[model samples]
Target: MSESKDFLRSIVEEDLKSGKYKEVITRFPPEPNGFPHIGHAKSICINFGIASDYNGHCNLRMDDTNPTKEETKYVEALKDAVQWLGFDWGKNVYYTSDYFQKIYNYAVELIKMGKAYVDSVDEEQMREYRGTVTEAGKRSEYANRTVEENLELFEKMKNGEFKDGEHVLRAKIDMGAANMKLRDPLLYRIRHVNHHRTGDEWSIYPMYDFAHCLSDYIEGVTHSICTLEFENNRDIYNWVLDTLGLELPRPYQHEFARLGINYTVMSKRKLLELVEEGKVSGWDDPRMPTIAGYKRRGYTKESILNFCDQIGIAKANSMVDVAQLEFCIRDDLNTKVPRVLTVLDPLKVTIVNYEGSEVIDAPYYPHDVPKEGSRDIPFSNEIYIERDDFNENPPKGYFRLTPEQPVRLRHGFIISCKEVIKDETGKVVELKVEYHADSKSGSDTSGIKVKSAIQWVSAKEAIKAEVRVYDRLYANEAPESLEDLNSSSLTVIKDALIEPAIVTEKIDERFQFERQGYFYADPIDYTDEKPVFNKIVGLKDSWGKKTAPKQESKTESKKQAKNEQVVGTEVAMSDEQQALFDKYTSELKLNAEVSNIIARDEKLSSFYADALAELNSPVGIANIVVTEVARELKEKEANELNFTAKQVSQLVKMVDDKTISSKIAKQVFEEMVKSGDNPDKIVEAKGLVQISDPSVISPIIAEVIEKNPDNVEKFKAGNNKLLGFFVGQVLKATGGKANPQVVNKLVAQALK
Candidate 1:
């Protein structure tokens, strides 16, 4: 599916060209102990994807060596995850437990060759005997046992004559080996647990190291690809196969880094705990990182596959921004799913002047989407809009409805608020609006202009639904405990309203729910009487909006992957460039990765150097130069730029001196780009001074807290991610003039 070759694929391609084997064979061997997460998805894509690319076969193998932990349900889940990701394991599914007899026979042969022995050390004693990284272990006295004696004891042990921990089989490898795994590692462990497949047929089960290589050889696997954690175990993998004098075309293991996304956990133990402890509904909980979770949440197979391909393969472990995954889903659904109007938080509206109801034809997809199909959308005097669409005290850039402002109902008439109706509690329950008779979408004569069109559903014909909005599982970017679980990860809107065509027409299982996000009908729970839609992902890159200096809009984050993600075309640095990189990292204290990217681009490097000369704030100056200034320098030389490097330094100085926030600096930079004005003048004219005064920002934070009681509860319940939400809201309220640092402190305190 991809043109260029990763390291693993390169190996397979070379092996085939060199006639190393007649056909390439790979296997995805997951231990059936827990559900597979996104990490396993990466491995499955690699092993099965390479096989498909090379016209080979990939066997789906279950490495069920630990009977105590293995289960049949987990095996099925693993199989389902692979198939759901759109891959097939040719022929029959393979299980390592099926080869227990053969593996035991190989162990017997090793004993006959005086290369194996049975050790009778307790658990703590075994650890002590294995020695440390620096020290070498002494050979056990049992290593000197006769081959016949060892064979008898091994047979007796297998015959269930020994207790669970009485004895164990170990390869008589180098006891003094530096690699701890090679220091006569255990070939078999004693476990009285019932086997999921073999049942109680035998008391002995071969360990993973003793069985995996043999299973691969027995199945004629050519390339054994695995994650980096198994790199050290490769020696044992090879030692077992080579020492046995296995047939040619034996599998050779290759390692690649596993997938790791921030704000999520991939450990099976952690995931299992999440399921077993009822932290989530199940392993298939949409908030979990499991493959079934993603599928249940409405993510398409194409999106997950594209994510794996776009992230590419790497040799070193790295934490990917979850935003990359979000971008992939949005990109996939942008042109594929139908755009339907669904309001999660509905606000009722009554058109006072409009008299009659009519059905207007609305395209299922926007004009940008290539597909063409329209559904009947009922337009009535009474309709429901998103509660967030209307504001009593509208902000500076508020485009939705307000008392003094008019908004167009999507696919319907333009309406202005004539009155606001409230309940006894003083909450605005409904809006009495008057509509422009000729201002309907697609054809208008009254010449009315509204700020923006808001999604609405006819109160008479709208379908009621349960929309489950799922957020990330962890509050912390790098989670360390169960306490990091996001309490507000799942928000269920039981009374969500949607247009009739969504349920009656049923164009697709997945849909872009207008301004909300992409959603999928709950396969297990959806019914004609009760429709349950789970939000797959938001419309934009949420992690970006939350992490950026200011909240980025959908249009701003439209091509985040295109702008932020790039192939590491890290050209070999010249001596002069290397010196610059070294100085930037050591003397200037610039981030090494950021410095590397800038140092490689000649125009960016020159501009960065000039900016650095103007200001001693290496980090701040380098940031603006590489990001904003570099954006201009990309298509034009530094000399052709409107703003000079000195202007960039001045912008950084304003941010450093607390005269402006980084968010304000960004605005000032944009102004400089447009008019080549000094940042100081831009800040002065716009009155964009940093609001460091706690007196001003604290009240704003208090108002945000009052407005978002749900988020306030979430923050108190360990959902630290909501702190950004509160901060972004305050900043928006202040028209980006609030000091983010003060807002952050005040919000945390208010929420607490």
Candidate 2:
């Protein structure tokens, strides 16, 4: 498809083609009162994206009419965020403060032309006159003020002749118009406060309605793109331009829908509240929807742009699923991040029979990646595997390690559990396993076929890293509707043991722990020795587990068992127990056949069986099969679901694994469904694999240096700003495949 014809572009194109305007000019006029958020990013992208597509100029104009809230800090952050998103306003940067003199002159001219007048009404009285949406507002008593008197009062208001909000200048528009914005809206407000840029030069500032259109005209902006909220204001935008009688290209306003996502509050006021109330760390909090927040959280500009493209422009407002946003992140990250292993929740496993002196070389990427490079990762008698991998009494259809089952220690040897060591609290402290020396990884002679391969990090070379496991900021999909403000959903796991490779100088890189999800070094908090990593998004979808019906079923089953015992002595059931039984019986009546089918499936683990019985909804299973499984199959473009019905059914059986988040998992499943690829392979190829291993990525740093000589030279030439350039080059070289934090550290080392 051609890039020059987005919806807004098409409008501009039609306008230009029809000779409505000889040249197309646009402006991104941000109110410099607050930092730009992700919502603003969409506007920036739309405005600049359209202007660039149409070969037009876009002015970066600051709508600083509200000097009470506007600040230079916000202006700088806005500029940075726009540039970071890869758009340029060139030399057309402007401020409304720059046109204060002109705007004041225009207001005076309007008063002289009997198009404006001085109003003595207070703020409350003004609102009373500017009636409700359905009612016509009462005309101001001062509406018919003579031009000479109106102009004189307006000048007095500008010359600090009155206190703020005492007397104001209003446009002499109709008060009975259906659109309330045109009801003699204030052209200028009396504010004695010092302006951030203009200082105490004037007392009156032009209102948004009056100054915005005039500023656009002064800059010769041909098209003024704004959100749909301004649709009604379009009339006024044109009025100010037409009244000026300016022969310049008067800008036409086009409105597009503002982007909104589920579970997110996009209002700048609410976002600021989040920051001020300490709900989030700052504006750049990964949990925040701000552009800076996303950048800090390891999102790429390309991914954000791609998401905008997928959502497309719409004339009406709509809410986009947060899953789609995550999908784009995973899609971009997967293609670019490299695969590595780092255990977040660590449990020690002793290979009892293996010699303590043993160490092996593991290739950073798969053998197919470079085909020649491999780094030595120390392997010994002791290693740490995920605690969830082992089950004392193995459940039905469980394929991971158990009492007698042998499992492959990824990139190492096959090990069989011989003993489970427990601490004083009776918790399994460690696992004693015996390894087959002959069954080394990459050696087929051992002839060992295990049911599953578990990932591990050697305890001897492990790095004590802080791993932050981030969940959704809100527990509810529609958090804005909820009244409770205390429901925080973020969990930070600080004590995580990772591979020694992770402890290397490349602390800022992202690494995919094999069988785990993607993770990135927390750039703001991480250091070379004690790296802190944030779980960008998990490898799987676990949201269903928290809200799954299994808990209710367990409670119901227990209640039934207790009621039956009580009824042995007494004949009547309590109201609550009877209600529970009735509900259960009703469910059985509704889905007996599907429930029977699930009960008869011997291959399904007890966990899933209970979940199915509790859920008692065939629709749940059907959704899992169709939406989750089938969708995954389609994403992977598989000929058939080859993993197995047991494997497919087991998804519901086990509590949702925390390897990947539900958001990330849904995205991964979508990719799998479309491509017919294994989850690991899909994740590896796409950089969706979370990096938990430091050792594996430490060496990938060397490879990044070998690949980018230009960036290395730039870094050494004292152009430190080129650090991001190097990071971008590394990411580009890896196809967004390498962990960026690791790339940053490694690039720094190579340059030094």
Candidate 3:
């Protein structure tokens, strides 16, 4: 472990350096009354991360002070979740109940010291005595009780001599203190309910405030890092330690803002209500913000940790854009997860020209990644493509399949749509297509080009699977603002067909369906024959529709005039006009402000018309000119923007190789916006290159191990923590020249 000098770490470092304590210790005390959420992840990471980084020890303590709400089941689940997050509590695991006798003796000691007494004030009376922010509270009549009498009463109350809520032990602190928590807070209360761990032995329990500070002192914790809400309670925390004259360690408290996303209510109580009221499936529902939920939804722990790091500990409360979280997951999954194709909404397509009994063995990965062997996918004359891929009446900029339009069938041959096969209801049931044998993907033939390449699965070899395409649980960015009891935001698509290649032994694994986005195997519902996958998050935010300009040709205008005269009414707008209308309607939505409410609305319509009137291109205006642009000007934090719609769309385009590689595109994108320059110009000036060549990375890895002799020795000595140090030094040596994947593999081999 190394010395940490961050705000919280600095406190610990100063304490240790000044001989405040011989050794450092910390505790991650969670109340085991409910399942932990992403907010809890921050506390877990901070406590355990700091301890590990500083060579200190962290205790996984359950503050099960409230017997009525706490349970053994919750305790077990919490422990399992903490371990799953890749943290160990070591040998210092404890419960507040474990120190019941010790805490009782401390309370008796306080009573004898004239610092605490048993009070008969009921709940309502006690609340009244604990005055508001502007006023001071009056002392209770029991505040000056004799030590002999207080001790006798406290013992009897604990021995079942008093009914529940009749008597409580309270500290004799100043009622005039500005902080409400120090106004003679309750130390112990009579609870007749049976305890989960210590059954029937005692009828009283300690409150959180009383138990927490003392637990830290008893365990010799150096720092008590907690969320910002507990900032005001620091006074009472220190008072308890100071009055007792105990051998307290550093135990200095530091507050960090809790993690709050745009569309989430991080409150444990509200989350529980959502689970109980059937708004979500369970604690592990893919839509939930719980760690288990995220894990099931294909979010890697590394991604989560990176996200926490990016949204560093701050003093002020801030709402982190959910896009940042998604970005973290995408960045992590993109490198590790293998790509595959699966169609959710299928429309059958038959190649009339192609001969029968033909099969193609298409390679899976475009770039060779070690350990991920290729699979043979059967391609026949018939296949299923996305229903939305084809349109009967094509509009301008519609690049996908249409009448007489040629499109590449992913890894198969280039095909042209000849005719549409329809049912009696005028619904398109199938498409008749002709394939060019010379334009087979692997065959080197000239003059083969298409505007669109659509994904497909062979109808004969396709596997029937349940693909749960999950969207935002609420249509609104902030669903918590909805007052309706039935305003649930989740939708589930039950049936889907996927390529057989995806059904290998790693069917339980997660993969990106190329253009479709990321998905995870449903652990509960998936089977060998029928796989079920849940859409974790989309490749890009595809919530809104694209609008095209209306066409008014001379021939159509004459027919429209005749129809208008017959009904004495003007003809309604065309499909393009209606699309524009819908877009405007979307921009007008007055939903809650979580993400970019204004930009999301603007994206819904032709509001860009007004925007473009003041700018050059409507597309450019829509992308680069918005409230977010202004927000970046004011705050300089791109993450604090209300919406990331433009950034997300650009990222998708970059990945598709429209302009530059994703790595360079990201760097240029950030710089262009910050410096107010053209993206293309910035890319040229910086000469930011994406290192895809593995040959260049091999030597750099060897050099990195040679340079960091100490870290190399540590790695060989079973100090796996130093592996990251080697990676960092390798990245630095190359000036980030080496490809990370190649460097990781080469370094692992060198160490072995």
lDDT of 1 by residue, 1-752 (tens): 32346888899989999999889899999999998989999999999988977879999999999999989999999999998887889669999988999999999999999999998878788888888889998777788889999999999988888899899999999978988899998998777778999888778889888899999999999999989999999999999999999879789999999999998999888898888898999989998888989888888888899789867899999998786787678667776888888888889999888788889998887543568998998888999998888989964656679999998887778899989999999999999999998887778897876656678999999999999988888756779779877666788989999888888989899988866677999989999689999988865443432332325543463444236521111123555665676677546756434566576678888888888889888888876775567657757987788899898898999999999987678778878988999999989998889887898888888887887797788788898877877887888788777788788788878877
Candidate 2, 671: how far from true, in Å? Answer: 20
**How much does each candidate deviate from the true structure in C-alpha RMSD?**
19.8, 12.9, 9.9
**Any residue pairs clashing in model 3, and if so which?**
222-251, 473-489, 474-489, 583-604, 583-605, 584-605, 587-601, 596-642
- The lDDT leader among the candidates is 1
For model 3, the superposed segments whose C-alpha errors exceed 4 Å read 1-5, 248-250, 366-372, 444-448, 475-488, 505-508, 542-751
lDDT of each: 0.83, 0.69, 0.70
lDDT of 3 by residue, 1-752 (tens): 21114577777778778898777777889998888878888888889888876678889999988888888878887887788787889865699888889999999999999999999988899899888899999889988789999999999988999999999999999898888888998899999988999999989999888899888877778888888899988888888888988864437777888887875766778778878887788888887788878877778888888787767677788888776787677656755676676777889999898666556665554332233455666788888988877889876655668996788887678888898999999999999998888887778384765765678888988888887766554433444633422232454556577888788637338877756677888878878687888887765433322111126443463454444411001122344543443343233321111112223433333334544444333333333333234335334444443334454344334434434553345456567556655555565676545454667766777776776687677778899976776765666555453456566776777789
TM-score of each: 0.74, 0.74, 0.77
Q: Tell me the tens digit of each residue's lDDT in model 2 across 209-281.
A: 8999888888888888989999999989887778868785577888999988876888888878788888888
In candidate 3, position 271 carries an lDDT of 77
lDDT of 2: 0.69
- Candidate number with the higher lDDT (1 or 2): 1
